[model samples]
Target chain A: MNVPLPNADHLVGIVFLIMIGLTITGGVIACNANRLVRAVAGLVVCFVGVAGLYYFLNSPFIAMMQMLIYVGAVAVTISFAIMFAAPEESKKHGPPGTLAGPFGLITAGLLFGGFTLLALKTDWQVHAKINDGSVETMGKLLLTEYAMVFELISIVLLTAIIGALIIARRGRSS
Target chain B: MEILSLYNNLNTFLIIGALLFSMGVYGLVTRRTLIGMLIAAELILAGASINFMAFNRFTAPDPQVGQIFTLFIMAIAAAEAAIGLSIVVAIYRNYKSIDAEDLVELKG
Candidate 1:
């Protein structure tokens, strides 16, 4: 199967590099933006880029789910929260503390750089695989091996739904 | 050394996860409002999910394990967001402001 592998591989590599850049840039924007709503917008951009990376990782199902849940549902919810609660000023910068803002930025930057160095320097081992991580295999394993977790998550979701209802409704009475 | 090719490696995902986690941590520490903190918490959950997915793709005996675990994390994060938002709503009703600085009546 000597099918001119380098060309295809390099193309994929370029695409992957672009996706990684998009994700990192969006994340930087999300964390560092001056306005809260713009930060939320950056988060949506980051999530969409991460979904692209998931597709590159050979799990299209997870990638699609990532888009649906994070970009579609979660981002919308966060934007709604912003609309209702966050400040409308586009250039408020930050809170009133003098030293806190710069200190927080430097701390986050250091942590990110340290992690990048560690990840680049270390050698990782990949062990044998039981399955190829396909959607069919994922479904079978979910139903067969992780059934208990599936049921527990359903319960958790139900509780969250009820709790959200009660908490939001409590304000209506007053 | 093809280090820049780190973009194609599993460790790249791990490093990205760590970056996201630290951003979340920074946001959690610095945000003045409850909803902003909630957004940061979601970022932290996302970082954890990315780690699980990366390990699943690279090292695990059963690759589906990580995917399943990530799915569960997503469910949990959604639930957490719903509950957290509701609480924020209630707190806003009670306090008239959602600023973390203002909701300090319980402080001694």
Candidate 2:
């Protein structure tokens, strides 16, 4: 193998920064877009950026699921709903309430500030890992330790799909 | 140089999670439509998942626990989106509009 360059770490850092920028920018677009379709597009972008962050966090499995589920399934579903609902063009431009915009900004800002302070100030205790959180370990745990939760999630998904179909099908003219 | 190694630090991930959470809150509060609110809710869930994974990587003794929890969260979020979108569709079918302001039947 060729010798690694000293500046390779810096390049990785730059890429991380770029991913952060992508996430924040996408989030801003998702929140501020006037068109619902545009907002969904922003959501897809934000999710992709988040998947990058997951890769950085050392879990490629979760990252792949993030992209597959959030970007592929969820975003597409939202867009389809938008197409079905057919929101009026004129009404889609305004905030929900008169004070909602400023009040929301203030509330979110305060939350962000508080969380940042808490994260920075508190000394979080780190513990030694019993096993590497690799894909193999995760698979075993899902079948063994987390089996109950896994089954419960499947049940929830089943109910959700059935409920969604029923709800959407009700009051149809046909 | 320190900035380059920021990914190894826990605080960096925490701050990113906070940012995503706040953006989601803002979107949820200010959106004028149900689907918009749902999108924001997904952002909120994403932020929570990030925090969980971050802690899983950095702090927790049993690293797999947080991953499992995050996976569970994703499952729940998918279910929520399905139900919510269907509800939005139903409301639209009845009202012929999905605007949050127009659904004020109980606005006494």
Candidate 3:
């Protein structure tokens, strides 16, 4: 029996490269853009690309969840924040005393170079699989092994929702 | 050595994760607005997720565990975003602007 290899065709390879490009470009735009709204837009693009990477990682369920939660919900929330709380234009380019563009670039470059070296030099070991990482397996584990954490997360989400409403609703009689 | 075939390697994903993380660091430090910093923080979270997923695909014995961890990270990020945005709104309501520099009453 022959198992088919993923991304063996050249077309998938090209698409992977394109997704990488999109991720990098979107990250640059999100971080470096002058306007806040544009930065949010960039973030949406970046999250979409990250979802694509999840697909490539052989986790389609996670990929769809990534797109739904991050790109769809989180990005929309940030854009809404931008619309409601648009920052002032005065001295928007740089803060008062902290380091600016070049220093940031240098620092990020050093970090990137260091991490790349580490990744390339280290030999990652593979282990035997317990399951095929299918959606069914994930669901079963979510209810069996990780049920407590799942319930706790729901509670946390509820608390966050209430806390947000209370904090934002205060001091309204100005 | 072949760039096109990089999709098949664990190191490739690790390198990309590292890049995303460094970009987040850069954005966090250089951004002057609250929203920009939040966006950078999201990038950092994404980088961490990618790292976990990469390790899961290549090294971990149980792949579902990593996906579970990533799902939790997504949940935490969502809650953080909601609370952070609400705080930003409150700050804007009080100061009439969302610039980090303007909200410096507690400065030493």
Candidate 4:
């Protein structure tokens, strides 16, 4: 039995709007928060909303990876660094440069306006899809056509791990 | 209504990407700490990734390429975060503070 849901499309649209709201709200919190921990929390929220955006973009695998790599690993690592560095509350409460806030806002506003105009004015062309962009296709391409870059990424990750350990471990014995 | 179908629109994604990118720029400019700058940098990268994914979904001839590119972006972001945080730790240990203004030792 096919029951027609009249408002389903509208509901989905509302959900998308909510996701956008979540993303922007989190970004504002992350950028504007005075406390580092609160900023990190905002980062987490923003990433979650980005993951939802990825879902809307029709790539569930990338969305899951966004959650796993960004929210899980990156955000947690940042919080760990926050704990290690311990940015003091008293120190952070000092005044910022007089022109920094307004200057940054103006810069960002100009950038946003320019990009929005570009996106709106340009006639984006749609092309025919060769593959469905599924996990299977992604895996095959990763191992075949893009194998070199894949291997290189792994090497880079290894180097980063070793380098990070060495750098963070320095001056410990003194 | 047409607004109800905004998810299918390419401009929507592009606008969102632009918004995020600008926010990142604002954050990077205004933030006073190295780690905060790093976070803003991550936001910038995320905005770029979203644009790639949007183009992949709407316009690309081969969808796999964009997804692959985004995956590589994620890997690089992870590595960057690891390296950047470690550096933050090292800087804190040496200077005993992570404030960007305090590290102006070369202001000769």
The candidate that achieves the highest DockQ relative to the unseen native structure: 2
Q: TM-score of the candidate numbered 1? A: 0.86
Ordered list by DockQ, greatest first: 2, 4, 3, 1
Q: Write one digit per residue (lDDT tens) for candidate 3, span B10-85.
A: 8988988999999999998888778888999999899889999888887887778889999999999999999999
Q: Where is model 4 more than 4 Å wrong at Cα?
A: A1-6, A89-95, A128-131, A170-174, B106-108
DockQ of each: 0.53, 0.76, 0.72, 0.75
Candidate 4 residue lDDT tens string, B1-108:
677688888899899899989999999989888888888888888888999999999899888788899999999999999999998999999988888888898376
Residue A83 local lDDT, model 3: 83
Q: Estimate how well candidate 2 is docked, as a DockQ score.
A: 0.76
What TM-score, computed on C-alpha atoms, does each candidate reach?
A: 0.86, 0.93, 0.90, 0.93
The C-alpha lDDT values of all candidates are: 0.76, 0.88, 0.86, 0.88
lDDT of 2 at B28: 93
Which portions of model 2 miss their true places by more than 4 Å?
Answer: A1-6, A128-131, A170-174, B106-108
lDDT per residue for candidate 2 within A1-174, as digits (tens), equals 776565888888888888788888888888888888888999999999999888888888988998999988999999999988965644567866789999999999999999999999999886655336489999899999889989999999999999999999865576
Q: Please give the lDDT score at residue A3 for candidate 3.
A: 48
Q: What is the lDDT of residue B10 in candidate 3?
A: 88
Superposed by TM-score, candidate 2 places the C-alpha of residue B17 at a distance from the truth, in angstroms, of 0.6
Which regions of candidate 1 deviate over 4 angstroms? A1-6, A87-93, A113-122, A128-131, A170-174, B1-7, B106-108
